[model samples]
Target chain A: MDYHWDWLFFFRETDDGLKYYDWILSGLGWTTLVSLASLALALALGSALGVMRTTPKRWLVAIGDAYVDVFRNIPLIVQLFMWFFVVPELVPDRLGMWMKQDLPYVVIAVVGLGLYTAARIAEQVKAGINSLSRGQRNAGLALGLTEWQTYRHVRLPMAYRIVLPAMTSEAMNIFKNSAVTYAVGILELYFQYKQIIEKTSQVLEITIVVTLAYFALAFLMNRLLAFIERRTRVPGLIVGGKGSN
Target chain B: MSDFDFSVILENWGFLAQGLRYTVQVTITAMLGGILIGTVLALMRLSSLPPLQWFAAGYVNIFRSVPLVQVILAFYLILPMVLQMITGKQMPIGAANSAYFTFTVFEAAYYSEIMRSGIQSVPRGQVAAGYAMGFTYGQTMRLVVLPQAFRNMLPVLLTQTIILFQDVSLVYAIGATDFFGAADKITQRDLRPVEMYTTVAVVYFVICFTLSRLVKLLQSRIAIIR
Candidate 1:
């Protein structure tokens, strides 16, 4: 317990002229950017895949299942490595060169994280759809809606509502999972911990600060999502209803 | 541009196999340890005691909020210092050993949540029935409640283990030579990122996908029994 505790170390300027805390703030900025961008991509693609899995067509179901199996089965760090290092070489020469040399690391990190999370979200979406009673779909059909139209107008809206809380959890998950982007050398918050510790050997301080940053971010995200959940709640729905707990 | 050079994989089979063994070892160890500790935490949370509930809730929330990679790194840095203070001796547990400790505690937080739901899923009437039969609370929990709860949670617990299996690869950040780490080492040496990464990805896919299918099968069987 004889270790010297330097609380003011974060205010000290670094070689880049920015204070260490400022550098950490930029890392937090990258983390937020990657998480939000990737979450947007995951929601769009995952909803489509989820709907595909529920369709009557065998081929669409197979495609959806395959996407989940492939993406969900592999560890994310390995996937990030492949996306960063291996994917570029597999493409056409000009496109490969562009991906390798010109594309920002953030885009690759986002795509990798987005694709991986999309698989998990697709499962959630599928579960939400399945949880709805048969009458919901039957009512849509009886109302003269086509299958696609039924999903759009009737099923998806309700399914999304029922699964809002779970989806919110996934939103929180992506924020934490964004830390894995450090593997691809994105300068996110967790990555900054490494950089700072290496530079100053302030391992304990850096770890504590970075951990607190994540805690604060997650707490705020949870509150914001809970507010959104409450604002959009359906009175008789599973999430906000009396029977849920 | 070049042919897929899986020859590197075959050439390094021995090294790769050892690494895969380590991955499986950590997964099994952490899975068992997590569930053990998690069950205790679950019971603590479900207890009527306020202090016990608060402690369990705080542990689960804090662990769940932070990223696993950060926790892994934090433990990697902090465990040695803590160990030194406790033992009054300098003892640096290496990356691989620390991975064991960190994943167990980290996965416990997640496992506790699943177990909590499992416990709650058991009907209150069942507990009442246990009490009517003159069973004490501990006896009722051991004989009646936990068995049913564990059966209900088996598929979910297994699914979590599959996730734990994949997450063990994160130990690479601290330089542990698990399966992915082994592949990474070979890739760095042979400079064949494509072959090494593809092989590792396929290996992970085959194992995890098959386990997921089995879990689904088990779930259906449990549903049938119920």
Candidate 2:
């Protein structure tokens, strides 16, 4: 075999190493920002929909169900493309032009990632809320709390705690799915790697770096979530056990 | 705009049909290949030896952590170069086929984890009974454990298949002319992105919705068996 290892090329400036490194770092920064923003959006939207899904009002339940079903059924990439390319055109001319020109790519990334992941997150949040004992809600009602106040004071915290694991997985998924932004010309880590490989033809080295970088970042995110889980764990509930892995 | 334009679809029927065939082929190939590799990885993960478990963990982690598109792109670009160096022969097919192979491999990683969970969900008593009845460990796994595990895992396996079907569209990035690529091509050619994509989306919805119902039916049947 005549395969020559070029591991050194990744580190040496003579091979445009600095430029590649900078590109990758910036990509990682955007990826992190997009993931965090989307995580927040998904949590907020998914929670509201999830709560509304359990509402006694028929219309509210219908709306929540429709939101979940429509978004969940569609593929994320298709949705991203539609939002980035098509949605703007449907807006008023001035607003549409401004969105096409001035809207940051990260904003599109957040919307795409947030809405796509929200479907799954909604399911998780609903599961968490449903898993709580019925008596808990009743007790809140008995204490003179309104339906909304009962949920706010009693159900939400417990549901959030119970669903931590699933939420972590969902967040991880959103982070990974952010890679789809590359299709819309966002220079995230995966896109950066693609550009570098195409330019330098150092395919293996660039791929290795990209893969390692993604794995490390994902691992760190998992650990961070795990830490939060540990810190916020209910005292009498399930304690440290084997990871879902 | 015309409420319906049958002629545009009729004109592009050949391309769309070809894309559908490729999409179905990729989904089936990935499903079968993923299940086989996934079964092996699940067994390895469940093995008594620490090294085997660790190796399986590493494999799953690497594939699961990285984005599927990156994997496809890597295999498309790097596989041929490495193959050339080793075999002194060019890979006959270009980047697109390699991307399909990558999708299959990546799907295997996720499928293995799902299978492992299914295997672990099997009651330990079944394996013990198999051993008591003179079955070896492998026989216990194959005859006793796996059958039940598979039944338990049917729903998840079906979900994975649906996801894999959707992921077949990613081959578009590497120029494989699958369903999404065909839609994209039509959009570019006809300058009607909305109509083309809407058609494609409906096609995806029909397939996915039907598969999900099938999954529900399988789950009910499995419940009856239990």
Candidate 1: C-alpha lDDT: 0.91
Model 2 misses residue A146 by how many Å? 1.3
Output the lDDT of residue B176, model 1.
93
User: Clash number for every model?
Assistant: 0, 0
Clashing pairs in 1: none
* Per-residue C-alpha lDDT of model 1 across residues B64-98, encoded as one tens digit per residue: 98999989988988899889888989998999999
Instruction: State residue B15's C-alpha deviation in candidate 1, in Å.
Output: 1.0
Docking class of 1: medium
| Local distance difference test values of all predictions, in order | 0.91, 0.81
- Model 2: how far is A82 from its true place, Å? 0.9
- TM-scores of the candidates, chain A only: 0.95, 0.92
Residue clash pairs of candidate 2: none
